[model samples]
Target: MPSPTMVASFRMLSSQRPFLRHIRHTPHWPGKWPTVSHARQLTTGSRELEGDSPQPERPKRRQKLRKIRTLDPTKLSPRDYVDFSMLRQPNVELVAQSSDLNDASNALLGRLSATINARGIRDGKFPPNTAGFLYYHTPPYSPPLAGEVRFRITPSPDTASLSEGNDLLTEYGIPWKIPLLHMTDKKGYTGLQTLLLRDGLVTPQLLDIATSISKSVKTLSRIVGGA
Candidate 1:
Protein backbone atom coordinates (compact mmCIF):
# COMPACT_ATOMS: atom_id res chain seq x y z
CA MET A 1 0.00 0.00 0.00
CA PRO A 2 3.00 2.41 0.49
CA SER A 3 4.97 4.07 -2.29
CA PRO A 4 8.15 2.10 -3.34
CA THR A 5 10.52 4.91 -2.32
CA MET A 6 9.17 5.14 1.25
CA VAL A 7 9.12 1.30 1.64
CA ALA A 8 12.77 1.17 0.50
CA SER A 9 13.81 3.81 3.06
CA PHE A 10 12.23 1.77 5.97
CA ARG A 11 14.11 -1.41 4.87
CA MET A 12 17.37 0.55 4.72
CA LEU A 13 16.97 1.82 8.31
CA SER A 14 16.07 -1.69 9.66
CA SER A 15 19.17 -3.26 8.07
CA GLN A 16 21.48 -0.88 10.07
CA ARG A 17 20.73 -2.80 13.38
CA PRO A 18 23.15 -5.66 12.43
CA PHE A 19 25.84 -3.18 11.44
CA LEU A 20 25.51 -1.30 14.78
CA ARG A 21 25.70 -4.62 16.68
CA HIS A 22 28.91 -5.48 14.79
CA ILE A 23 30.45 -2.10 15.80
CA ARG A 24 29.55 -2.63 19.51
CA HIS A 25 31.03 -6.19 19.55
CA THR A 26 34.40 -5.03 18.13
CA PRO A 27 37.39 -5.37 20.62
CA HIS A 28 38.60 -1.87 19.67
CA TRP A 29 35.41 -0.10 20.71
CA PRO A 30 36.40 3.18 22.46
CA GLY A 31 33.63 2.89 25.15
CA LYS A 32 34.57 1.06 28.35
CA TRP A 33 32.20 -1.68 29.51
CA PRO A 34 30.68 -1.28 32.97
CA THR A 35 32.47 -3.49 35.52
CA VAL A 36 30.40 -6.25 37.04
CA SER A 37 29.87 -5.68 40.76
CA HIS A 38 28.27 -7.50 43.65
CA ALA A 39 24.68 -6.54 44.39
CA ARG A 40 25.84 -5.15 47.75
CA GLN A 41 27.85 -2.50 45.94
CA LEU A 42 26.51 0.79 44.65
CA THR A 43 28.12 3.40 42.42
CA THR A 44 28.05 5.83 45.36
CA GLY A 45 27.65 5.06 49.08
CA SER A 46 24.98 6.92 51.06
CA ARG A 47 26.25 9.20 53.88
CA GLU A 48 24.67 6.91 56.47
CA LEU A 49 26.34 3.86 54.96
CA GLU A 50 29.86 5.15 55.74
CA GLY A 51 31.30 4.07 59.11
CA ASP A 52 30.78 6.95 61.59
CA SER A 53 33.55 9.41 60.68
CA PRO A 54 36.38 7.15 61.89
CA GLN A 55 35.37 8.08 65.46
CA PRO A 56 37.86 10.95 65.39
CA GLU A 57 40.67 8.97 67.07
CA ARG A 58 39.47 9.86 70.55
CA PRO A 59 42.23 11.95 72.17
CA LYS A 60 44.17 9.38 74.16
CA ARG A 61 43.45 9.90 77.84
CA ARG A 62 45.98 9.03 80.55
CA GLN A 63 45.01 5.69 82.02
CA LYS A 64 43.16 6.25 85.28
CA LEU A 65 43.59 3.96 88.31
CA ARG A 66 40.57 3.17 90.46
CA LYS A 67 42.89 3.15 93.45
CA ILE A 68 46.47 4.40 93.52
CA ARG A 69 47.52 1.35 95.46
CA THR A 70 45.80 -1.91 96.16
CA LEU A 71 46.87 -2.73 99.68
CA ASP A 72 46.49 -6.23 101.03
CA PRO A 73 43.52 -6.23 103.33
CA THR A 74 45.19 -9.13 105.10
CA LYS A 75 47.24 -8.07 108.07
CA LEU A 76 50.89 -8.36 107.09
CA SER A 77 52.12 -9.16 110.62
CA PRO A 78 50.88 -8.85 114.22
CA ARG A 79 51.96 -5.71 116.03
CA ASP A 80 55.19 -5.98 118.01
CA TYR A 81 55.84 -3.92 121.09
CA VAL A 82 58.91 -1.70 121.14
CA ASP A 83 60.31 -0.89 124.62
CA PHE A 84 61.30 2.62 125.55
CA SER A 85 61.32 1.52 129.19
CA MET A 86 65.08 0.84 129.14
CA LEU A 87 65.62 4.52 128.48
CA ARG A 88 63.83 5.43 131.74
CA GLN A 89 63.07 4.00 135.19
CA PRO A 90 59.67 2.60 136.37
CA ASN A 91 58.93 1.20 132.93
CA VAL A 92 55.19 1.81 132.80
CA GLU A 93 54.43 0.59 129.29
CA LEU A 94 55.93 -0.27 125.91
CA VAL A 95 56.24 3.04 124.09
CA ALA A 96 54.57 1.65 120.99
CA GLN A 97 53.43 -1.41 119.09
CA SER A 98 53.95 -1.64 115.34
CA SER A 99 54.89 -4.12 112.62
CA ASP A 100 58.22 -2.43 112.11
CA LEU A 101 60.37 0.46 113.32
CA ASN A 102 58.56 2.74 110.92
CA ASP A 103 55.17 1.94 112.46
CA ALA A 104 56.59 2.12 115.98
CA SER A 105 57.94 5.54 115.22
CA ASN A 106 54.57 6.55 113.84
CA ALA A 107 52.82 5.30 116.99
CA LEU A 108 55.15 7.25 119.25
CA LEU A 109 54.49 10.34 117.21
CA GLY A 110 50.75 9.79 117.42
CA ARG A 111 50.93 9.79 121.22
CA LEU A 112 53.00 12.95 121.24
CA SER A 113 50.53 14.62 118.91
CA ALA A 114 47.60 13.80 121.20
CA THR A 115 49.34 15.43 124.16
CA ILE A 116 50.09 18.57 122.18
CA ASN A 117 46.59 18.67 120.65
CA ALA A 118 45.09 18.47 124.17
CA ARG A 119 46.89 21.74 124.99
CA GLY A 120 45.31 23.65 122.07
CA ILE A 121 47.97 23.75 119.39
CA ARG A 122 47.01 23.57 115.72
CA ASP A 123 50.48 23.56 114.23
CA GLY A 124 50.67 21.61 110.93
CA LYS A 125 53.04 18.70 110.34
CA PHE A 126 55.05 19.69 113.44
CA PRO A 127 57.97 17.61 112.24
CA PRO A 128 57.89 16.71 108.56
CA ASN A 129 59.31 13.26 107.67
CA THR A 130 58.90 11.78 104.20
CA ALA A 131 61.89 9.51 103.61
CA GLY A 132 60.20 6.36 104.85
CA PHE A 133 56.70 7.65 104.27
CA LEU A 134 55.06 4.41 103.15
CA TYR A 135 54.95 5.67 99.58
CA TYR A 136 58.57 6.05 98.56
CA HIS A 137 60.15 2.95 100.09
CA THR A 138 58.59 -0.04 98.35
CA PRO A 139 61.56 -1.78 96.80
CA PRO A 140 60.91 -5.32 95.53
CA TYR A 141 62.16 -8.10 97.81
CA SER A 142 63.45 -11.62 97.01
CA PRO A 143 60.69 -13.31 98.96
CA PRO A 144 57.46 -11.50 98.20
CA LEU A 145 56.91 -9.44 101.36
CA ALA A 146 53.55 -10.69 102.61
CA GLY A 147 51.11 -11.45 99.86
CA GLU A 148 50.55 -12.89 96.41
CA VAL A 149 52.45 -11.50 93.47
CA ARG A 150 51.10 -7.97 93.47
CA PHE A 151 50.93 -5.45 90.70
CA ARG A 152 51.31 -1.71 91.10
CA ILE A 153 51.71 -1.98 94.84
CA THR A 154 53.20 1.48 94.92
CA PRO A 155 50.69 4.36 94.74
CA SER A 156 49.79 6.01 91.45
CA PRO A 157 49.70 9.76 90.79
CA ASP A 158 46.01 9.67 89.89
CA THR A 159 45.13 8.35 93.32
CA ALA A 160 47.91 9.89 95.39
CA SER A 161 47.72 13.46 94.05
CA LEU A 162 44.03 13.88 93.27
CA SER A 163 43.71 16.91 95.51
CA GLU A 164 45.55 19.30 93.25
CA GLY A 165 45.14 22.12 95.76
CA ASN A 166 47.35 20.50 98.43
CA ASP A 167 50.44 20.65 96.26
CA LEU A 168 49.86 24.30 95.29
CA LEU A 169 51.61 25.50 98.46
CA THR A 170 54.33 22.86 98.11
CA GLU A 171 54.80 23.68 94.41
CA TYR A 172 55.06 27.43 94.87
CA GLY A 173 56.92 27.41 98.20
CA ILE A 174 60.57 26.47 98.99
CA PRO A 175 59.49 22.87 98.18
CA TRP A 176 60.29 20.72 101.22
CA LYS A 177 63.97 21.51 101.50
CA ILE A 178 65.27 20.46 104.94
CA PRO A 179 66.80 23.26 106.99
CA LEU A 180 69.89 22.47 109.05
CA LEU A 181 73.46 22.67 110.28
CA HIS A 182 74.58 20.03 107.71
CA MET A 183 74.26 16.25 108.39
CA THR A 184 72.76 16.91 111.80
CA ASP A 185 69.60 14.81 111.38
CA LYS A 186 68.74 11.38 110.08
CA LYS A 187 65.89 11.28 107.58
CA GLY A 188 64.11 8.59 109.64
CA TYR A 189 64.46 10.50 112.92
CA THR A 190 63.30 13.75 111.34
CA GLY A 191 60.29 12.12 109.72
CA LEU A 192 59.11 9.91 112.59
CA GLN A 193 59.50 12.69 115.16
CA THR A 194 56.38 14.38 113.79
CA LEU A 195 54.23 11.61 115.25
CA LEU A 196 55.77 11.89 118.73
CA LEU A 197 52.47 12.38 120.53
CA ARG A 198 50.81 9.43 118.84
CA ASP A 199 51.49 6.97 121.66
CA GLY A 200 52.51 8.65 124.93
CA LEU A 201 51.02 11.36 127.10
CA VAL A 202 52.96 14.54 127.87
CA THR A 203 55.71 13.91 130.45
CA PRO A 204 55.64 15.54 133.91
CA GLN A 205 58.71 17.55 132.90
CA LEU A 206 56.65 19.35 130.26
CA LEU A 207 54.07 20.39 132.87
CA ASP A 208 56.83 21.72 135.10
CA ILE A 209 58.25 23.68 132.18
CA ALA A 210 54.83 25.15 131.51
CA THR A 211 54.43 26.17 135.14
CA SER A 212 57.84 27.88 135.10
CA ILE A 213 56.92 29.78 131.94
CA SER A 214 53.67 31.01 133.56
CA LYS A 215 55.47 32.22 136.68
CA SER A 216 58.15 34.02 134.67
CA VAL A 217 55.43 35.96 132.84
CA LYS A 218 55.26 38.49 135.73
CA THR A 219 58.99 39.36 135.52
CA LEU A 220 58.73 39.92 131.72
CA SER A 221 55.57 42.02 132.33
CA ARG A 222 57.51 44.37 134.75
CA ILE A 223 60.18 44.89 132.06
CA VAL A 224 57.68 45.70 129.24
CA GLY A 225 54.74 46.77 131.54
CA GLY A 226 55.09 50.59 131.23
CA ALA A 227 53.66 52.72 134.09
Candidate 2:
Protein backbone atom coordinates (compact mmCIF):
# COMPACT_ATOMS: atom_id res chain seq x y z
CA MET A 1 0.00 0.00 0.00
CA PRO A 2 2.97 2.46 0.42
CA SER A 3 4.42 4.46 -2.45
CA PRO A 4 7.95 3.35 -3.86
CA THR A 5 9.71 6.62 -2.92
CA MET A 6 8.38 6.34 0.67
CA VAL A 7 9.46 2.71 0.90
CA ALA A 8 13.03 3.70 -0.24
CA SER A 9 13.14 6.46 2.39
CA PHE A 10 12.00 3.95 5.14
CA ARG A 11 14.85 1.58 4.17
CA MET A 12 17.36 4.42 4.49
CA LEU A 13 15.95 5.40 7.95
CA SER A 14 16.12 1.79 9.13
CA SER A 15 19.85 1.64 8.06
CA GLN A 16 20.67 4.74 10.19
CA ARG A 17 18.82 3.53 13.39
CA PRO A 18 21.94 1.93 14.92
CA PHE A 19 23.98 5.08 14.27
CA LEU A 20 21.29 7.29 15.84
CA ARG A 21 21.16 5.07 18.96
CA HIS A 22 24.98 5.26 19.29
CA ILE A 23 24.96 9.04 19.03
CA ARG A 24 22.14 9.37 21.66
CA HIS A 25 24.25 7.43 24.27
CA THR A 26 27.55 9.29 23.43
CA PRO A 27 28.66 12.29 25.62
CA HIS A 28 28.85 15.91 24.21
CA TRP A 29 26.87 14.99 21.01
CA PRO A 30 24.83 17.96 19.45
CA GLY A 31 21.86 15.66 18.68
CA LYS A 32 20.80 12.02 18.03
CA TRP A 33 22.82 11.96 14.80
CA PRO A 34 26.19 10.40 13.94
CA THR A 35 28.81 10.34 11.17
CA VAL A 36 31.87 8.11 10.68
CA SER A 37 34.22 11.15 10.75
CA HIS A 38 32.64 12.56 13.93
CA ALA A 39 33.01 9.20 15.73
CA ARG A 40 36.74 9.03 14.66
CA GLN A 41 37.36 12.65 15.82
CA LEU A 42 35.78 11.87 19.27
CA THR A 43 38.00 8.76 19.69
CA THR A 44 41.16 10.77 18.78
CA GLY A 45 40.21 13.61 21.17
CA SER A 46 39.77 11.07 24.02
CA ARG A 47 43.26 9.64 23.37
CA GLU A 48 44.81 13.14 23.29
CA LEU A 49 43.07 14.09 26.61
CA GLU A 50 44.40 10.93 28.33
CA GLY A 51 47.94 11.73 27.16
CA ASP A 52 47.76 15.34 28.45
CA SER A 53 46.71 14.25 32.02
CA PRO A 54 49.37 15.19 34.61
CA GLN A 55 51.10 12.58 36.82
CA PRO A 56 53.10 13.22 40.01
CA GLU A 57 56.91 13.35 39.66
CA ARG A 58 58.99 11.39 42.15
CA PRO A 59 61.38 13.27 44.50
CA LYS A 60 65.17 12.84 44.17
CA ARG A 61 67.11 11.54 47.15
CA ARG A 62 70.46 13.00 48.31
CA GLN A 63 73.48 11.07 49.57
CA LYS A 64 74.72 11.80 53.08
CA LEU A 65 78.48 12.45 53.61
CA ARG A 66 80.50 11.65 56.75
CA LYS A 67 82.16 14.43 58.75
CA ILE A 68 85.85 14.21 59.62
CA ARG A 69 87.59 15.65 62.70
CA THR A 70 91.11 17.13 62.56
CA LEU A 71 93.73 17.15 65.25
CA ASP A 72 95.63 20.27 66.46
CA PRO A 73 99.29 19.66 67.41
CA THR A 74 99.56 22.96 69.24
CA LYS A 75 96.56 22.17 71.43
CA LEU A 76 98.03 18.77 72.22
CA SER A 77 100.40 19.05 75.20
CA PRO A 78 102.37 15.83 75.55
CA ARG A 79 103.97 15.26 78.94
CA ASP A 80 107.15 13.34 78.39
CA TYR A 81 109.31 11.83 81.13
CA VAL A 82 112.95 11.06 80.26
CA ASP A 83 114.45 7.62 80.91
CA PHE A 84 118.11 7.70 81.98
CA SER A 85 118.73 4.01 81.23
CA MET A 86 118.58 4.81 77.52
CA LEU A 87 121.27 7.52 77.66
CA ARG A 88 124.28 7.19 75.36
CA GLN A 89 127.89 8.00 76.23
CA PRO A 90 128.28 11.77 76.71
CA ASN A 91 131.33 13.98 76.03
CA VAL A 92 132.87 15.21 79.31
CA GLU A 93 135.37 17.97 80.12
CA LEU A 94 136.02 20.81 82.61
CA VAL A 95 136.39 24.40 81.47
CA ALA A 96 137.61 27.45 83.46
CA GLN A 97 136.05 30.31 81.43
CA SER A 98 133.35 31.17 78.90
CA SER A 99 134.94 30.68 75.47
CA ASP A 100 133.37 29.62 72.16
CA LEU A 101 134.55 26.03 72.53
CA ASN A 102 135.31 26.26 76.25
CA ASP A 103 132.38 27.89 78.01
CA ALA A 104 131.60 25.56 80.94
CA SER A 105 133.20 25.69 84.39
CA ASN A 106 135.76 22.88 84.84
CA ALA A 107 134.25 21.51 88.06
CA LEU A 108 130.59 21.75 86.92
CA LEU A 109 131.31 20.26 83.51
CA GLY A 110 133.39 17.41 84.90
CA ARG A 111 130.86 16.65 87.60
CA LEU A 112 127.89 16.57 85.20
CA SER A 113 129.65 14.48 82.56
CA ALA A 114 130.92 11.94 85.09
CA THR A 115 127.64 11.69 86.95
CA ILE A 116 125.61 11.10 83.79
CA ASN A 117 128.05 8.52 82.40
CA ALA A 118 128.67 6.51 85.59
CA ARG A 119 125.03 6.11 86.55
CA GLY A 120 124.11 5.09 83.04
CA ILE A 121 126.69 2.34 83.13
CA ARG A 122 126.41 1.20 86.76
CA ASP A 123 122.62 1.09 87.21
CA GLY A 124 121.75 0.92 83.53
CA LYS A 125 119.71 4.01 84.30
CA PHE A 126 120.31 7.71 84.62
CA PRO A 127 120.71 8.77 88.25
CA PRO A 128 117.47 10.32 89.48
CA ASN A 129 119.55 13.14 90.98
CA THR A 130 120.64 14.08 87.48
CA ALA A 131 117.13 14.13 86.00
CA GLY A 132 117.61 17.84 85.44
CA PHE A 133 120.04 17.01 82.64
CA LEU A 134 117.21 16.23 80.22
CA TYR A 135 115.47 19.57 80.74
CA TYR A 136 118.54 21.79 81.43
CA HIS A 137 118.07 23.49 78.08
CA THR A 138 114.28 23.85 78.32
CA PRO A 139 112.45 26.98 79.40
CA PRO A 140 111.24 28.92 81.37
CA TYR A 141 114.85 30.19 81.10
CA SER A 142 115.06 30.35 84.93
CA PRO A 143 112.79 28.00 86.84
CA PRO A 144 111.95 28.19 90.55
CA LEU A 145 115.17 27.79 92.57
CA ALA A 146 113.64 28.25 96.04
CA GLY A 147 114.78 31.95 96.23
CA GLU A 148 118.34 31.34 95.07
CA VAL A 149 120.25 32.78 92.12
CA ARG A 150 119.25 30.86 88.96
CA PHE A 151 122.35 29.53 87.19
CA ARG A 152 122.18 28.23 83.68
CA ILE A 153 124.63 25.39 82.97
CA THR A 154 126.55 26.10 79.76
CA PRO A 155 129.27 24.03 78.05
CA SER A 156 132.93 25.10 78.43
CA PRO A 157 136.42 23.86 77.48
CA ASP A 158 138.95 25.22 80.05
CA THR A 159 140.52 22.26 81.90
CA ALA A 160 141.25 22.27 85.63
CA SER A 161 142.65 19.68 88.08
CA LEU A 162 140.36 18.53 90.88
CA SER A 163 143.34 18.86 93.27
CA GLU A 164 143.43 22.61 92.48
CA GLY A 165 140.38 24.60 93.58
CA ASN A 166 138.88 26.85 90.86
CA ASP A 167 135.91 29.22 90.40
CA LEU A 168 133.62 26.25 91.07
CA LEU A 169 134.71 25.85 94.72
CA THR A 170 135.52 29.54 95.28
CA GLU A 171 132.82 31.66 93.65
CA TYR A 172 130.18 28.96 92.99
CA GLY A 173 130.93 27.04 96.15
CA ILE A 174 127.23 26.76 96.93
CA PRO A 175 126.71 24.43 93.97
CA TRP A 176 130.14 22.74 93.98
CA LYS A 177 130.66 22.26 97.76
CA ILE A 178 130.97 18.64 98.93
CA PRO A 179 127.67 16.96 99.80
CA LEU A 180 128.66 17.06 103.53
CA LEU A 181 129.08 20.82 103.38
CA HIS A 182 125.92 21.93 105.18
CA MET A 183 124.04 25.01 103.98
CA THR A 184 120.96 26.74 105.38
CA ASP A 185 119.68 26.97 101.83
CA LYS A 186 118.61 23.70 100.13
CA LYS A 187 118.46 25.23 96.65
CA GLY A 188 122.29 25.55 96.49
CA TYR A 189 122.79 21.76 96.47
CA THR A 190 124.05 19.91 93.36
CA GLY A 191 122.86 16.68 91.74
CA LEU A 192 125.78 14.85 93.38
CA GLN A 193 124.27 15.39 96.84
CA THR A 194 121.02 13.65 95.90
CA LEU A 195 122.85 10.73 94.26
CA LEU A 196 125.07 10.22 97.27
CA LEU A 197 122.17 10.50 99.70
CA ARG A 198 120.40 7.68 97.88
CA ASP A 199 123.46 5.42 98.20
CA GLY A 200 124.95 6.51 101.58
CA LEU A 201 126.66 9.47 103.28
CA VAL A 202 130.14 10.14 101.85
CA THR A 203 132.80 12.86 101.92
CA PRO A 204 132.20 15.82 99.57
CA GLN A 205 135.57 15.19 97.84
CA LEU A 206 134.69 11.52 97.31
CA LEU A 207 131.26 12.43 95.92
CA ASP A 208 132.82 14.90 93.50
CA ILE A 209 135.26 12.27 92.29
CA ALA A 210 132.44 9.76 91.95
CA THR A 211 130.34 12.26 90.00
CA SER A 212 133.17 12.84 87.55
CA ILE A 213 133.55 9.09 87.15
CA SER A 214 129.82 8.76 86.44
CA LYS A 215 130.12 11.34 83.65
CA SER A 216 132.86 9.31 82.03
CA VAL A 217 130.84 6.14 82.43
CA LYS A 218 127.78 7.78 80.83
CA THR A 219 129.77 8.57 77.68
CA LEU A 220 130.84 4.91 77.42
CA SER A 221 127.32 3.76 78.22
CA ARG A 222 125.94 5.87 75.37
CA ILE A 223 128.22 4.15 72.87
CA VAL A 224 127.61 0.63 74.15
CA GLY A 225 123.90 1.18 74.76
CA GLY A 226 123.46 2.27 71.18
CA ALA A 227 125.09 -0.90 69.96
Best by lDDT: 2
Report how far off residue 188 is in candidate 2 (Å). Answer: 13
Question: Each prediction's TM-score against the native?
Answer: 0.17, 0.16
As a whole number from 0 to 100, the lDDT of residue 139 in candidate 1 is 28
lDDT of candidates 1 onward, in order: 0.30, 0.36
Local lDDT at 199 for model 2: 26
Expressed as tens digits, the lDDT of each residue in 49-156 for candidate 1 is 676466667788653211111122221111211111111111112233444676645464334311111011123322222111111111257221111111112122
TM-score of 1: 0.17
* Candidate 2 lDDT over residue span 144-169, tens digit each: 22112111122221111111322121
Quick one: RMSD of model 1? Answer: 21.6
